[model samples]
Target: MTVEIRVSRSPGERRVALLRDGVLAGYRVERPARPDGVGDTLRGRVVSRLPALAGGFVALPGGESGFLPESECEGRRLPPEGTILTLRVTRAAQSGKGLRISARVKQRPSGPLALLERGPDQALRWAAAHPAAPLVVDDPAELARLRAALGPRATGGAAFDDALESEADSLALPETPLPGGGRLIISPLPALTAVDVDSGGADPREANRQALPELTRQIVLRDLAGPILLDLAGLSLKARGALEPAIRSALVGDGLVQALGFGPLGLFEMKRARIHPPLHEVLADRPLARGLALLRLAAREAAAAPHRVLALSAPAPVLDAIRALPGALEEFAARAGRPLVLRDASLEEVSDA
Candidate 1:
């Protein structure tokens, strides 16, 4: 039952891993391009109201707009266009949708369209939720910040446990091996996520039962939201019905998830509230991720071989992205004590040559 939170910070990205009994139970990534404004408070101007949709779009800071549902207005009528109001961000923008905002704040601050209060960092927010769990942070500045935010509970050390790091990295893969020779194939589609339970020649019911824990863990770790369709390996109606309680029990900790039971098409249906985008969506920009990865690799190489000059090669677009990111190349050169050579390679993979 022991739980710990580990945070690793790098230029342009922050990774947080939740470990339960030394196992990676949950993982989250925060990047500058994809900001998860879950708890930010802002003053926004209503742009338009659509009675048909029962919501309106509010112009937010930085040229972004959010949808404020009528239900989130605390029973107040939708304000006319051009009315300024204090708002809180309920969910981050995801899947081509803008942020979901609510107008139910304790105090309404009148002002121009701007960010009023920045939300807690993801690590601090997680620490608040699991107050008892000790926070292990790698970066000195982040550790100091966490200590100021939550005294005594934050400590300095390596954030990623070796085994847990490997496990967390593998989360990007589509296939997950289950106990008893079975595996789960998780595919995130545009409309809904689909999970197929492969029994691997074992008893269907037993395999499905064994996959429940890992399945739920993946759901939480990946932050998979929206409609999820599960296709259990060959099972009878009675067997599927019998597994309902177990499925519900497995999803006990996540309040956002609701088991909707089986559909007419024999697929098990569940819905998780859409907040932050899922892991796949967060890593959707492959070139950007690759560029960041190359920078990290260069850093590691410099540490391992202090005297070896490093040259990073990648696609032209990837190199352009790296050069354009503020402080990205500068930080690497500062840490490595030598400028890195950048080369344009037509290959898809990034490498330190």
Candidate 2:
């Protein structure tokens, strides 16, 4: 019904268009010229922090990383050497580097976080708009010091009445599996997106052909990504007729939807009209890795048998999940009946698992 478009004037800022139901609904653009990077948080482990560039790998965090410029690296605690943390995507991922940033949240009285760590134009606008109240400060430590400053406005809650009304709505939303067995994780963005189908999870439906089209619809509506690329395997010749219209209907609030049938490699392509980074990209700080991982490595030192030892290499929080993997791995390793030893990756970090 109502469509809005936002564009920035300077370079470095992204140009975004948000669409719903095959129609234009929103637009946003980035202008490097803008100064506004306050509260953008992304969780990732520092893969390789290169002092030369001042940044490293975050598991291709957001498909890339950039220089964590000395200016942004404000504190010793801020994504210190090799810390698995929530950094901001301040710039395009480096040529061999990736988007780099120190995350902090920037907010105004209004909802919908406008800028995270650095976006000058947006910050000024937010400040001007909320003159009556104190504009949110950007200092990560200082900001964290003020917990209830915003009170009920914290992003997670809604009015009790509206919440009750939403229960049914929330329940109605489907929980479908992804191409792999893992759950389909959707945070919805306002920008275009590129997803990598690295591994699978638990659900069997993830293997279904129908899941492809459905994923497209849910993704657009949730992340608001326009010009999407679905790169999962299989589905080279499945019928689009089974799902297009539903996807079209979902875009009712956005704008035009155009998609080419699945390509030779099974990558389905589609685009929506939008102007913001799809929610997922902004939020996808960390990859979906089970804290406790199975280390079925082939080796000269195959302890007690065939495969290898199962290293419980996660921190305390994920120990439970790691502990649960042994049974599954044991079943898989049973044919050879090899002894699976649980080793820790970090010789120094001793955790519960």
Candidate 3:
């Protein structure tokens, strides 16, 4: 299968879409202000150990702390309180949980709490993982940075296709239409994500069968990890058991996913490794996301009417969030080659004049 990676850049976020045979297969979003520290190596001081929890907290740089599990210590003893240890971030902080770190004592170095090594950004990591796939980016600066980092491997131009962007944007929606008039309603909760399979008058078994592939695709594209409960449309206990193979087959390539069969409540249970914040969580801050979206709109308007002075009007909170982003408005104005007028108004009121 032909695979390609496309990157889209805005002032507030960078979105990466992985396409297989011209179909959107995977999607990832990265924000400039909040990075998911999944592979960072840091020198941290052990805070305390709890035998009951089988883990201890380690104070990281920048006043953040991560939990170091005993299992991740390579069967070695946990470091004592206040002892400095080399640690690698295994998972990002998400859902009210701190980061998950593991001891990398073999590369131990004496130093104050600080970042020892920065992890490769998501796009570069994706490129390294899929060497055969061509990495195409939209922004020239991003392309140059990738070229500097990957050298000859970064052989692609600014080609973030509009159709691909549209497809990726649709992934942000909670409802996904499936074949044969069926649809999947995905909702992410604090405990576990729930996927309701609505047959939409289609045959139950067929709808359930057709929903598997798209369901898995949505799961991966949304980066939905941890516990997932699927309520199949009108599937019996025996029928669900019979369809186990199909469910497992749908989630084949992703090593992090595990199919745990059907639960007592008739919900199919699955678990995925939590590495980074899910897409919903990444965009959870509604005001911030809306503010960035407004900026994107302002950029388009500015491009369309270069001579007109663009004025953005929105709620105070949204405007405040936009202003809080360092150089966001300035970058937009610089790219637009004009200053933008900001106006505060009601939440429902938004306009670019």
Model 1 per-residue lDDT at 322: 81
Worst 10 residues of 3 by lDDT: 344-353
TM accuracy, model 2 = 0.28
Error of 1 at 94 (Å): 0.8
lDDT of 1 by residue, 1-353 (tens): 99999997665667899888987877898875446888899999999999999999999998999999998886757888998989999998887788999999975757788989888767877888798999998767677888898897989988876777778778889999999999999999988999999999999999999999989999999999999999888998777878888888988878889999988878889999998889999888788778887787787788789999999978898898788777777767776788889988865344433
What lDDT would each prediction earn against the true structure? 0.86, 0.38, 0.84
State the lDDT of candidate 3 residue by residue for 143-244, as single tens digits: 788889777656555455678757767877899999999999999999899999999999999999999999998999999989999999987898878888
For residues 84-175, write the lDDT of model 2, one tens digit per residue: 44456554431222345553433123222222234333323333444332322322222333324433222221112333223312322334
Q: Which residue pairs in model 3 clash with each other?
A: none
TM-score of 1: 0.92
Off by over 4 Å in 2: 1-238, 254-268, 272-353
Model 1 deviation from native, Cα RMSD in Å: 2.7
Candidates in descending lDDT order: 1, 3, 2
> Which residue runs of candidate 3 sit more than 4 Å off their true CA positions?
105-108, 152-159, 304-307, 347-353
